[model samples]
Target: MVEPVADQVLRAIDQVRERYYRLIVIVGPAGSGKTSALQAVSALTSAPMINVNLELSRRLLNLTERQRAIHLPRILGDIVQETAAELVLLDNIELLFDVHLHVDPLRLLQRLARNRTVVATWNGTVGPNGLTYAVPGHPEYRRYPTGDLVIVEAKP
Candidate 1:
């Protein structure tokens, strides 16, 4: 039987466990099966998988720029603790692409990965330019660094 590509990605993730490269960003176009990959991996893993929906996270709390920078990690940390999960799958991360939000999500996720492995779905394509969160000229146009990030491209 042929293993699905997500299994391959999961194997890579598992291989990197306990290593310095703990955070992975799966970048792909819409409907490219990134979320499905995460779900499948979550189901088969021994460690609990905490799926953090950025949309719900945004609605559940309101914070100032300073407060968000300080508290977002704490809030996510609480969930990780409650779920007893060493691996976290972040979905709907495009919500953070809103330009009005002052928090740098890449930095925040990077910080969180220091404590636990994070695999997030990015709603864009990764290329030579980097991880383009938004098209150029858009208010949210920002290319976060790909350095130290284990990038996986999800196939449809």
Candidate 2:
């Protein structure tokens, strides 16, 4: 039997405890149950789940494009800090990939994980090139080397 995504993420959390950046990214396509797995992990571990797009959008609503780009990292850090949880689950991170944001999505997550464990749902795939979001030639396309990040695949 295939191991459940939540279980895989839970195991990853434990495994990254001593790492500099305690981040576990759950990668899958749309409708792949990444959110459900994150919910399960949240319920099981009592960690707070954050909707990144909603929260970040709300916080950046009144900011100018330049302001948003300038303050994005600090805003994100504040959001994570507000959770006050050792482990934070983030979903709907598509906003972070917006070209206007002028920020590296994976690096933002890594920065957040420096202070606490972060398990985030990534609507993407892990390939030989590394973790990818969207596709080449797409406005939001992004790819990053796996580096020290732990990854959990959520298949439907």
Candidate 3:
């Protein structure tokens, strides 16, 4: 039988405890139950769950485009720090891929995971090329090698 996504994520979190960046990406297309799986994991572990888009948007509401690009990294760091949880679950991370943000989404996640475990929902797919967000030619499209990051596929 297939393992549950939440269970897989929990296992991945435990597995990456010794890594420099404790990040486990749950990759799947929209409506693929990524959020549900995150919610499940949060409930199971009593970890805090964050809706990235909602939280980041609220924090960036007053910043100009240039200021946003300059301050985004620090702002994101503050957000994660505010959670005060050793393990943080993040969903709706589409904002990090915004071209205007001038951020490398995957790298940003890795940075956040450096201090604590991060299990985030990625609206994308994984394949031979690596992890992908959106299609090529799309403004938000991004791809990255898996590297040391652990991935849990959220199959529909």
Candidate 4:
């Protein structure tokens, strides 16, 4: 029997908490229900959900490299820090893929993980190879190391 996607995500969340890990990336192609799974997990866990809207984050994205270097971390850092829950649900993280911005999202998430677990929805695919970012051949594609990451592939 096939396990429900939410169950799979919940299992991964459990592992992250049990192992004291930081990040659980739910990867899948668009229309694969990644966001829905995140919502369901949030309901079950009662974790505060933060949705990173690209349009809203544009202000930070537009900052000069020098300014962003100093403030971007502070901005994203605040979201993770403000949530007291042990596990935070992060959705619409595609904003971090903007090549124009100098945000090292995965690194930021990992840093936050030191305090709590982060379950984020990633618009991509995870396979035997690795996580491939949204855009094909994009610079962010296949850039993250998967060894420490707990990746749950969202099934349609």
Candidate 5:
């Protein structure tokens, strides 16, 4: 069965479709239904959604941490080709930020968002622009940035 998309996530997807390279961040306290909301959106849009768990795949890979950044796009590319989900979702983005990296995960996300739409679930905000990043250390993350990322948390 398809999940119900929250009003905010629905609105975010609508906004992203209107604007290219849109980066939107979804932030909330733990167990606050962040992942649920993302799932709902994915179902609502019928876009293949991938919940990229930060703790599991990004860190456990056997390759060097630096290579993760370089490798991530390839992995994502495979997934995109396999699934062909127009909208991509990255869940639990905290691990990507906290881990020591050879490549910037933010760049990868930005690069992916360049053409297709990406809805990422982050722990907090990222930089001031472009990347749809979570606020650093805010523990409330949801971003869709198109060169200038300005997040306004909605009441879900």
Candidate 6:
């Protein structure tokens, strides 16, 4: 149900990149072209890229509650400045976890959403209220549209 990446999407992309829209949530599944779309956008624009592979030791994507507190933010900020990137792109955001046992991407999301453009990749489905789900029973995300998060759905 993800709306095609037509002129509207392209325009949205331009609006965020050109005019500096704080948060650009690219909520989509593994192969939803979230990364690719961001890449293409970055390539075409002056945005820098910051791809943090959360596959290090933990399997979460939440920025808070992680024992590696101090350095991560510094590193993320550095990455942002390093690329002089106006747009920040995140991949495999499903790993963003929190102590609440629910995926807590708020801190990180809020941080980036504050002044930069962000597009994240996740694994889940589109829920009723334009939310993204890691699994059907898990928590839902209202940051982006469901279709935008899910690329395809295989019927059971």
Ranking by lDDT: 2, 3, 4, 1, 5, 6
Give the best candidate by lDDT: 2
Clashing pairs in 2: none
Q: How does residue 49 of candidate 4 score in lDDT?
A: 83
Residues forming the 10-long window of minimal summed lDDT in candidate 5: 146-155
> 39-110, model 6: which lDDT tens digit per residue?
666666646555555442232244554444434544554555565555566655543442233334645654
Using all chains and alpha carbons, the TM-scores for the candidates as numbered come to: 0.80, 0.97, 0.98, 0.85, 0.66, 0.59
> What are the C-alpha RMSDs, in order, of all predicted structures?
2.9, 0.8, 0.8, 2.4, 5.8, 6.1
Per-residue lDDT of 34-153 in model 2, one digit per residue for the tens?
A: 999999999999999999999999999999999999999999899999989999999999999999989999989999999899999999999789999999999999888886669999
Candidate 5 lDDT, 4-123, residue by residue in tens:
335666666677776656555665545657788777776777766665653347435787766766666677556545666667776766555544544455566667777677766655
Model 4 C-alpha lDDT per residue in residues 1-156, reported as the tens digit of each score:
977778898887777765655688888888888888888888888988888765337656677767765676677777677777778888888767666566777887677777788888888777666667755676765456688789888877
Better of 2 and 6 by lDDT: 2
Provide the lDDT at 28 for model 5: 50
Q: Which ten residues in a row have the lowest lDDT in candidate 1?
A: 51-60
Which of the two, 1 or 5, has more TM-score? 1
Runs off by more than 4 Å, candidate 5: 1-5, 54-60, 125-147, 150-156
Q: How good is model 3 by TM-score? A: 0.98
For model 2, the superposed segments whose C-alpha errors exceed 4 Å read none
lDDT string for model 3 (1-156, tens) is: 999898999889989999999999999998888999999999999999999899999999999999999998999899999989999999999999989989999999999999999999999999989999999999999988887679999888
